[model samples]
Target: MRTVVYLVIGVFFGIVLFKSEAASWFRIYEMFQFGSFHMYGIIGSAVGLGIVIVQFIKRYKVRSFFGDKIVILSKEKSFYRYMIGGIIFGLGWALAGACPGPMFVLLGAGYLPIVIVIIASILGTFLYGLFRDKLPH
Candidate 1:
C-alpha cells in the first residue's frame, strides 16, 4: 500500500535527519548564531539538490504518485510578505530550537519536550488556515 511506502520513506528520511544532525538543537543553534557552517552546509546542499530535482521534474514532466501532472507554480512576488513571514518563522525556530521539518523527528528521537513545539506548529497551521483568506496574499 502507499501507506507502507510512505512509512518506509519517512523512516529513511528520519534516519538521514538524525545522522546528518539536522534534528539536533545544537546544530540549529549554531546556524542561528553563525557559530559554525555545518548546518549551513547541509541546508545549502539540500537547496542545491532541490534546484536540480526541480529541473529534472520539469524537463521530464514528472507525475505525482496519484498520476496527476506535477506543476510547479510560482507565486506572486511580495517583499513585505516574505520579510514578515521569514521573521516570524525565524523567531519560532530560534525559540523552539528546531526547524519545522525536524520537530517530529526530534520527538521520535526521544526528545519528549518537542511535543510542545509540535502542538504549537499544528495550532499555528490551523490558525493560518482559519485566517489565510483574511490575511494579505
Candidate 2:
C-alpha cells in the first residue's frame, strides 16, 4: 500500500517535470547560457518555497506524514570541499544537460539516449559511496 502510494507520487512528479519543461535540455542550456529566465524563474520559486518550508519545519516542530519527528542536522562548513563539489556538479550538468532528478524523468519520457546519463549517474553515485570516507569532510 505504501509502495503504491509512493509510486503514484513519483509518477505525478515525473508528469509535472515533463509538463513544466523542467526536463528539457534546451531549458537547461538556456539557464546555463543566460539565454532566458524561464528555468531560473522555476528554480528560484522552488528555492523560495523550500526556504519557507524549512523555516516552518524548524519553528513548528513538523512531523513526517508517517508521524515521525522531522530532524534537520547542521553540518560543519567546508569552503574548499563545497567549492570543488559545486564546480564538478555544474560542469556535469552543463555537459549532460540534465541533473539527476530530471534525468530519470527524461528516461521515463522515452528519451532513450538518457539511459547513458542515468547509468553514468548511478556509477558516479556508487563510486562516491565507495570513496566517501577518503574524501574531505
Candidate 3:
C-alpha cells in the first residue's frame, strides 16, 4: 500500500539522519558554535542536492506517481518578512537544539524530551497558518 511505502521511506530517511549524526543535538550545537564542520558539510551537501533536484524537476516536468504535475510556486519577494521569519526559526532551532525534521527523528530515537519541541512546533505551525494571511506577503 502507499502508506506502507511512505512509512518505509520515512524510516529509511530517519536511519540516514541518525547514521549521519544529522539528528544529533551536539552536532547542531557545534555548527552554531563553529566548533566543527561536520554538520555544515552535511547541510551543504543537502542544499546542493536540493538545487539539482529542483532543476531536474523543472527541466523534466516531473510528475507524481499519481499522474499529477509537480508545481513549485513562486512567492512575492519580501525582505523584511524573510528576515523576521529566519530570525524566529533560528532562535527556535537554537533553543530546542533541533529543527522540525530532526526533532521527529530524535523522538523516534527515544528522546522523550523532544516531545516538548514537537508539540511546540505543531503549535507554532498552527499559529502561523491562522495568522499567515494577516502577515506581510
Candidate 4:
C-alpha cells in the first residue's frame, strides 16, 4: 500500500511537471532569462502549500501518517554555507541545463551525457556525507 501510494504520487508529480512545461531545459532557462514569474509562481505556490501543511501538522499535534511520533530536527542557520551551496547548485544547473531531478528524466529520455553529471552529483553527495560533520555551521 505504501509502495502503491509512492508510485501514485510519483506519477502524479511526473504528470504535473510534464504538463507545466517544467521538464524542458529551454523553458526553465527562459524563466531565468526574461524576468518571467511563471516558475517563481509555481515554486511560491508549492512553498505556500508546504508551509500551510506543516502548520496544520503542528497545530493539530499530529504525528505521522501511520501514527508514528515525529522527530523534528533543528536547522542550522549558516548564511555562508547556504550561499556556497546555492552557488554550486546554480553553477551545475546552468552548466548541465538540468537540475538533479530533471537530470534523471533527461537521462532516461536518452541524453547519454547526463550520466557524467549524475555521477558527479553522486560523488558530491557522497563527499558531503563524508565531511558534513566536519563542516562549520
Candidate 5:
C-alpha cells in the first residue's frame, strides 16, 4: 500500500535524523551558540543537495508520484519580509532547541518533552492559518 510505503519511508528518515544527531537538542544548541559545526554541516549538505535535486527536476520536468507537474516557485525579493520571517523562525528554534522538522523526529526518538514543542507548533500553525488571509502577501 502507498500508505505503508510512506510510513516506512518516514521511519527510515527518522532513523537517519537520529543517527546524524540532527534531532539532538544539544546539537541544535551548539549551532545557536557557535559551539560546533556539526549541525551546520548537516544543514548545509541538505540545502546543497536540495539545490541539485531541484535543478535536476527542472531540467528533466519531473513529476509527483501521481504525475502532477512539479513547480518551484520564485522566492519573493522583499528583503525585510524575509528578514522578519527568518528572525521569528530563528527565535522559535532557539527557544525550543529544535526546528519544526526535527520536533517530530525528537519526539519519536523518546524525547517526551518535545510534545510541548509539537503542541505549540501545531497551535502556531493553526493561528497562522487563521490569519493567513489577513496577512500581507
Candidate 6:
C-alpha cells in the first residue's frame, strides 16, 4: 500500500523528468549556458512549488505521506561544519555538473562520466557516516 504509493509517485516523476528532457546531461549543462531558458524555467517552477509546499506545511502542520509530522533537523547549529559541508557539496556539483538524483538519470541516459560522480558521492557519504557523531555540530 505505502510502497505502491511511493512507486506510483516515483514513476510519475520519472516520466515527467524523462518527457521534459530534464534527465539529459546535455540539457542540464545547456541550462548553465545563459542563452537557454528551458532549464532555468524548469528549475524555477520546481523551486516555486517547493516554496509553496513548505509554506503550507509550516502553516498547517500537515501530516506527511508517512502519516507523521515531518521533522526538520536543526539541532546541529555549528556554522563552521555546515559551511565546510556546503563548500564540499558545491565543489562536487560544480566539478561533476550533476547532482546525485541527476547523476543516476545521466547514467541511465548512457553518460559514463557520471559513474565518477556517483563513486565520489558514495565515498563522501560513507566518510560522513564514519565521522558524523565525532564531528562537531
Q: Against the true structure, what is every candidate's RMSD?
A: 1.4, 1.2, 1.3, 2.2, 1.7, 2.9
Q: Tens digit of lDDT per residue, candidate 4, span 21-126?
A: 6666787787768667777787789899988987887778778766877665568798999998999998888777778877767665677988999999999999
Q: What are the runs in model 3 whose C-alpha is more than 4 Å off?
A: none
Question: lDDT values of the candidates?
Answer: 0.91, 0.91, 0.93, 0.80, 0.89, 0.79
Pairs of residues at least 3 apart in sequence or in different chains that clash in candidate 4: none
TM-score of each: 0.92, 0.94, 0.93, 0.82, 0.90, 0.72
lDDT of 3 by residue, 1-137 (tens): 77987899899999999899999999999999999999999999999999999999999999977788999877889999999999999999999999888898999999999998999899999999999999977
**Residue pairs with backbone overlap in model 3:** none
The lDDT-based order of candidates, best leading, equals: 3, 2, 1, 5, 4, 6
Better-scoring candidate (TM-score), 1 or 2: 2
Q: Residues 59-106, candidate 1, lDDT per residue (tens digit)?
A: 999998879899998888989889988998999999999888799789
- Please give, for residues 1-137, the per-residue lDDT of candidate 6 as tens digits: 88999888876777677678877657767875675788789989999998898888878888977898975544647789989988888677667887676777677667797888899899989999998899876
- Pairwise lDDT winner, candidates 3 and 4: 3
- Which lDDT value does model 4 have at 65? 61
lDDT, model 4: 0.80
User: What global local distance difference test value does model 6 have?
Assistant: 0.79
> Clashing residue pairs in candidate 6, if any?
none
Poorly placed runs, candidate 5 (over 4 Å): 65-68
After TM-score superposition, the amount by which residue 7's alpha carbon in candidate 5 deviates from its true location, in angstroms, is 1.7
Predicted model with the maximum lDDT: 3
**Candidate 3's TM-score:** 0.93
Clashing residue pair totals per candidate (backbone < 3 A): 0, 0, 0, 0, 0, 0
Residue ranges of candidate 4 with Cα displaced over 4 Å: 108-112
In angstroms, how far off is 26's CA in candidate 3?
A: 0.6
Give lDDT: candidate 2, residue 42: 87
